[model samples]
Target: MAKKNVLIIGAGGVAQVVAHKVAQSAAEFGALHIANRTQSKADAIIQTLRDKGHRMPFASHALDAMDPAAVEALIRQLDAGIVINVGTAFINMTVLEGCIRAGAAYIDTAIHEDPARICETPPWYGNYEWKRRDDVAKAGITAILGAGFDPGVVNAYARLAEDEYFDKIDSIDIVDINAGSHGRWFATNFDPEINFREFTGTVYSWQGGEWRENRMFEVGREWDLPVVGKQKAYLSGHDEVHSLSARYPDADVRFWMGFGDHYINVFTVLQKLGLLSEQPVRTAEGLEVVPLKVVKAVLPDPASLAPDYTGKTCIGDLVKGSLDGKPGEVFIYNVADHKQAFEEVGSQGISYTAGVPPVAAAILVARGTWDVKKMANVEDLPARPFLELLGRMGLPTRVIDATGDHPI
Candidate 1:
């Protein structure tokens, strides 16, 4: 059978990585098309592909992803079988609607976050994406949410633990530690506004059939990881915990992120001056401005960090449970290198880690191994294939079992 055509949305750093990987695995996909709000950015990533001598047939277009009608029209035009959305979090619903209307599978890295709100309440998926679940089911389209690293692979870790190692999972601690550095004084590795907004809101976690909320940095601890040992990570609100809470209501779910002293200090100082607020306020000249927006305007774009990025990132799920009626716990994780990712995909380790998985999902959708005809999350699919794909794609998974750490 001929492979299905794919349309990749967005032209950011993650989108660049996705395009390269999709090109590398073009045999698994038919035509690979890309679209973005800015035509030049889309063309630029395609240019990289041409430089690499990619054999895949490629095309680029200008798109306003906020418009469902236009997006659906483009999908019909391309006859796309899968839409890989690595765009800004703001345009998720429109693109998903487009995919549903076009009768194509959909995949994305993170949950949709409204530009107006810093953070919504607990169960963030229900706020916007989940309401479309019934419509997706009615249309019989596969909509996979949060297919990125934390929300993406971490979800897979939880499923792997539940399926292979545990009889009854007691607790899950999702940890993301990036020991890599960009050699910059002060900057966020992702969108500055989005990064700051994530922490400024309530940190919600589900434990023992109850929800707990705390302020950012209010709870923190030190963890000794595989390569980057003894780093301090704080319990923070994250995208995966929201959906995991719904899936495993009985299991405790929480997320922690590693941060250095410099980042914390800078973030604290910016926040104290009200520069991180999403709300717009008047300046001395009476011009309306959102402080956080201004900060993002002045900060370095995350894509620029790749050239100077060095070190590694260790991310995984630590699951504690009963195995054959005996209490046990294990850490299932992947470690990525910045230099290796830059040489392979022209992106930093973080973006490489997040970008590669959704492309794997897209290829599986093309191959029919994961073309389930309904809305699903990464955890709802088999983990072995996904882990194997990552292993070949530069991010390999290793399990710390009772015997020792080794590849699965």
Candidate 2:
């Protein structure tokens, strides 16, 4: 069989990390191709690789990721056996379809979203990605959904708990704390539009074998986590909670994200003023624009924050259950430094953390370790190899319990 190539479908910070990591592991792939709506962004990333002295064959292409035919055409033209989709959440379904049509293994870092919907319902995957499960199976293509940090590594953490630590899992609390500083007055860690859209809707959590809902910032808790120390996190609707609830229906699944006072205040004001609305409205001059898009345009690009970004991020799963009929709780997490990430990948810790895992997934697909010809989430696959590969690539996993914090 010919060596499979990887086609990365984005050119943002996360995509930059993916490109670099893929280049570093060049021997695992045939050729690398990156495509985006703007070709220049792809060129810049490839140039960075060139400056870094990476000798991998890389090319850039222009693509409207929302157009499935265009994405499929690029995949076929590149002879890509795998598509690592680090694009915005809105493009997930289109990219998956393209991958299916092109017979390329699919890996995405986030759940698919409808441009017009906000927090459609619990089990978000079922709302979009899961609907295409039959199509994926029939085509015999592997589609690994939500392959980023929280949805990716955290999902693996849950599976690890089931595989080793617990016999009957009870609750899974996924906490994401970005104690990192981007040195900005107010800017999102990723795309401003996606960041704002996540919080502008109802907060959903799975508990007591049922779906629960609340307002964003309505439930806040202070966690004294390792390295980063104590920080305030809010229960927020996220991609993982939906699929996790379905997989571990008996367990309580919730996602908490750290937020400082400044962010809460700014987000509150924006929501109240309707400045975060995704719907388009006409101005006095009859020029139509989405308020959310306007806000995104004014904020600093997330990728730009890599240079001066500092501090660390601690994201992990707090799993509570019974082990050998004894009550137990274990926190499986990884701490990443922004400066270290930028020095290594030319991106901030947030992007680095989110970006690395999909490449690992791609490697597994190439190696046939995770090339299950069907649709699945991170938790549905074997966790150890993926976690081990992540450790070698950049993000290593550590478990905290009565045994102490040690690498797994």
After aligning candidate 1 to the native by TM-score, how far in Å is the CA of 250 from where it should be?
Answer: 1.4
lDDT of 1: 0.91
Write down the TM-score of every candidate: 0.98, 0.99
lDDT of 2 by residue, 1-408 (tens): 788989999999999999999999998899999999999999999999998999988899999999999999999999999999998999999999999999999999999888899888777898889999999999999999999998899999999999999999999999999998888899999999899989999999999999898999999999999999999999999999999998899999999999999999999999999999999999999999999999999999999999999999999999999988999999999999999999998999999999999999999999999999999999999999999999999899999988898999
Worst 10 residues of 1 by lDDT: 363-372
For each of the candidates, give the backbone clash count: 0, 0
Off by over 4 Å in 2: none
Candidate 2, overall lDDT? 0.95
Task: Pull out the clashing pairs in model 1.
Answer: none
- Give the Cα-based TM-score of candidate 1 against the true structure: 0.98
